[model samples]
Target: MLPDQSITEELPKDRKQKRQPHSAYLRRRLMTLTSIIIVSMFALEAAVTAWYDYRAQLANLEKEAYLLADAQRSVLAAAVWNFDFDIINNAVNNLFSMPEIMQVAIRYPDGEVIASAGKLSDGAAQMRITRPLLWDQGGEKEIGTLNVVIDISQVESSMLVKLTERSVTLSATLFICLAAIYLACRWMTQPLEELTAAITRLADGDLEQRIPHTQRNDEIGNVARALVKFSENSRLLYDLQNSLTFNVAEKTRQLKQVREDSAHDNTVRARLLAMVSQEIRSPMTAIQGAVMLCKNGLTGEIQEKTLHMLHVAERNCERMQKLIEVLFDIYQIQNHSLVLTLSPVNLLKLARTQTEIWRNKAYQTSKNLHFESGVAEAWVRGDEKRLQQIIDILLSNAVRHSGKGGEISVHLRREGALISLSVSDNGPGIPKKIRPYLFEGLARSDEACSDSLGSGFSLTLAKGLVELQGGQIYFESIAKEISSNSTLPTGATFYLELPYIPAPEAAD
Candidate 1:
């Protein structure tokens, strides 16, 4: 199956499980933001409350210290003025009875310490206030001094208890607020969760899934509606895709059938051509032999006009015989039945021999056929008859295309591990219109020479024969002047290459 066609297959079990849903991410973000806000609000409230309580407690403590001094001043002054040591001592002891009082002291006017009570340590908390005793109610005369010291430990303990209680309350409120916010967020995002699930199902190829909250008027509802539309569109697309797949498959089967029919037709055509060539060749060979005998005057001397006529008939017969042979060879190649009798042969000598035979023919006309070999000898493994046929085809093409007074050249040389035989002609080059299909059977140029009895079978036969012998054949054409009157470009060179093999050394 095609890669695209396998998309609907089940994904790996681990992959499906590993994918985190969209709702999970949204919930995580919402919880994190809500937690920060709740924590910040609690921290701010606790700080503000602690500051306010601290200031209030300090103010109340200062007021209580002043009030205690004011209430006890008359008692302390009278005791000190009467010179009663017990009364002064009792007054100091009474002041120290209060939990906030850390110490108390009474001093005489002469700077002598009259009384002192309570522990005075290095780390003891103390709030001090001094009041002077007056001799009369006018307070004009100073007699003695009363000093009271208040401890701040008890106040600190009270403030700590209050802060603890407020902290507990704030914690409970934070918990309740967070719970409410989480519930509200979950409720608001429930539609989104449903939409995400529907989309997942759609991706998994379940196009029937529908979002449940599409009727509600919210952003999530709009998304749900869009998801529903998407599911519908997906279903339509899947149907169209299936239809296209079925049509493509049907067309592919039809194409395969057409290809099979064409192959069978080609086979039948090749077989028919082979049978016809075999039938025609036998009688044509006999006719050629009889015509040769008559032309040689085996029976009697012939008239001049009759002899020319006989010669014409003989040549036509030979041409027909050659055509038949070419048709048979083509049929054999198309059927993959052309077998070569391979042997070690000198390629350079072979090329030279074929060139000489064609050179004599070229002399009969006003054409020049030149043969050049760069090496003393070049050897290869090939079928001699088949190789000769290829050379003949190439030379014939060069001669026919060159016309009279034209030049044709054949060259042989060793190139790397291969032997190359090249035939070139300075004629009107192969026409552009027919060059593409030059080696295709029966391909002829638009301006084929009227006097030439050339069929397009020669090059195709040559190419097939060369390839069958493990060789390659190709050609190059250059635009050049063929004549003075017409400067139109024309020239072509055909190349044949075969694997080189060294000939056995002569015995010493």
Candidate 2:
């Protein structure tokens, strides 16, 4: 018959369908602020009222003392002139009867008591002279004197009653005013409280929650409208952001697939080229051996011209094979999937030989190719073939890019533990914008097109080969503005620094 306990616990929302009113919350907040303000005002008002009451009591006592002095002058004059003790005694008795009169005494200028009525000590005039006293006679000659001691009890009592009445009225009025302020504050803040709750829900990811805008020409109405606009804009921006993220993710996935396919193609091409090179070089090698045997005339004499032709053909064929092998090596290096063939080499000699090889090409281009070395000998521990490739690539680049009738210089120096080799040419310099990506393989710029050897592959492969041998390569190029003269042609300079090994003889 009854629902389960867990279901019942969760079912309270159905019974209390109505949400809590914003007015109730606002009323509580206003009451708290109003209570603080009322308490502060009441404290200030009480302090001021008590001060005023104390001052009024002091003034009343002063006024009464002066009136008693005037009354004493008349009564004492009549008693002395008429020689009637009854009049003087009756006047003193009346003064004593007054509640403000604590004590009264009549004294001569010489401190002699002529008459006294009320409680006082034998020498009370001297002891009780803290409050100012008045004399009956105003002149310097004091034939007789009268003194009145005014009591302040009645004035204090009356002032207390007045202050108490004022306190009750002031308290009642302040309470009423605070109550009115509390009601007004609650009314003004009710809509704002509801709007805040709605905004809170929206901030917590509930886009559907929104403040209701009531039409009225007031700040509260304007704020409600502005909030509704903000909610709409936020919803649109959220959806747009999600769509952009999805689009970017999809594009990134496609780019990854393209890279994979390109990688696969490169692998297939490399394998096919390797097979073709092997097949071609084998027959060319056999022909060269046969040609060499005929040139030697083992069986018959051969013409000198025919022998010269065979030598040229063999050399050209070898060059082509070497180019193919270099391409294959570069690809393998890029894939990080190749092992280097390491050997110790005399780097200075290697560089000299490569420079001589490029001298003819540089001459044909009308550029002077020169090689200078300060090192007597420098040994390097690295792959001889790879290191030579790096040197050849740099030389070939210098020869190809140098201006006509320009100088191309190659310098090798054994500077401390480093073997520093530099190849610089006089030509149009490399552009600054493309300099950063110059060593990156397959990175080509329009300015590089000026050179016939500008495949953008040589520097990339050279850098890799040098690094594989535990060396570094960087280049610097001077601008045309710096090298203005045609003879001093602006060009790029490639600096190669490699670790040098101690010679076997030197070590011993």
Candidate 3:
């Protein structure tokens, strides 16, 4: 499999897989929540209403009973004072005739029965009462009782009739309110249903869908606005994706044409490389032979300056070969053809080695190169070549950006299962306009590229390679006022954090 296949894979588009509309979900959830609240409120109100009405009925009954008792008291007192038994019986009969006064009775002092009226008819029972009277007997005042009977059923029936009528009316009123509530819920839910249907259509590739507008500025209005935004965003994203796909397809066609042209170009380039290698190698070999012969004094004693010139040429040739190797590796990495023979690598050691190699170069430029580690060993499973390439790229960037006599700091720290390698330089930071695309190909700061420079593909290629090996790269550049370094107006820091793996044991 290609090294970058996983990174570039596009997820499939399935409209049917969309979630239910937020408005519908919101409406349903709101409706349920409202129902729960309303029911709870009404239930509490009903319990209180029932208790208050019952207490009022009891109070009314007690008041009416007291009034009846008082009226009966006067009649009995008049009859006793006049000593007219017939008049008392007649008054008692008259009181029982009243529909609410179901029964009446009276008793004289010394427990003798005086008079009685009415009967326990229709399952009604009589309620009993008493009054105290004083009578002289011998030398002491004696106690006697005047008994009265009132029908409790009479009071109960009257109060119950009134309460029943009120309850019937109240039940009808409650039913009407509940019916209205249900209808209002249905009417409100209609708009939500309409919004849901429109959104469903939109999800099914109907970008032209829209919700009906309302003058009401409630939650419904908010929902309408959100749905409209969602539809517009979906349409815009759909159009943008199509535009991108079309551009990609067109570029692919052009690339195919370029590939055909590049085939012939590659043949020419190969021939040119072979010829150049031969031309360069032939001279270089001849010069080496001549130098050996001259050292041996085959022709004559060579001057010190001439011998030194030959040595410089040989050194340049060796440097050119190493540069060619780097170029080939970069090409393979760009084409996504480089296969990594991944193994556990100790990152601390890698950083130490790269720091040592670049320290000399930094010294040559009158800059300080510093390497510090918070860990003795940090291991990762990755391609050694690619990892080395990343370290070199970061170090080279730091070295190039660091001012003369400035400092470049390379720090490695282990955080859990990952290792963090950060390279920071005391140099002018990236510009705001360029920071967004800083890692893209062929992008460079003017100051750093003034001296000997390579193609501006290293950072981009390094980022891609690190990501391919399950690592990430990020950068931060602080402003001059905020930064402690006075030599730089601003400075940039790059971080590469890679997952760590333990090293394999040597064969026993």
Candidate lDDT values, in order: 0.80, 0.71, 0.70
lDDT of 1 by residue, 66-170 (tens): 787777778878887777778777777777777777778888888788889987767755567887877786647898887777777666777778788878887
Report the lDDT tens digits of candidate 3 across residue range 18-135. Answer: 3323564457557656765676676566656665765676565446655665676665666665677887777677666656455565656556666777665666655555555444
**Comparison by lDDT, 2 against 3, better one:** 2
Residue 137 displacement (Å), model 2: 14
How many collisions between residues are there in candidate 2?
1
Stretches > 4 Å off in candidate 2: 1-65, 71-88, 97-102, 107-115, 119-147, 269-273, 277-283, 287-309, 335-350, 353-369, 374-385, 392-409, 413-461, 470-505
Q: Of models 1 and 3, which has the larger lDDT?
A: 1
Writing each residue's lDDT as its tens digit, candidate 2 over 412-462 gives 998788899999987777767767888865555465564333346668778
Best by TM-score: 1
Worst 10 residues of 3 by lDDT: 6-15
Whichever of 1 and 2 has more TM-score, that candidate is 1
lDDT of 3 at 182: 73
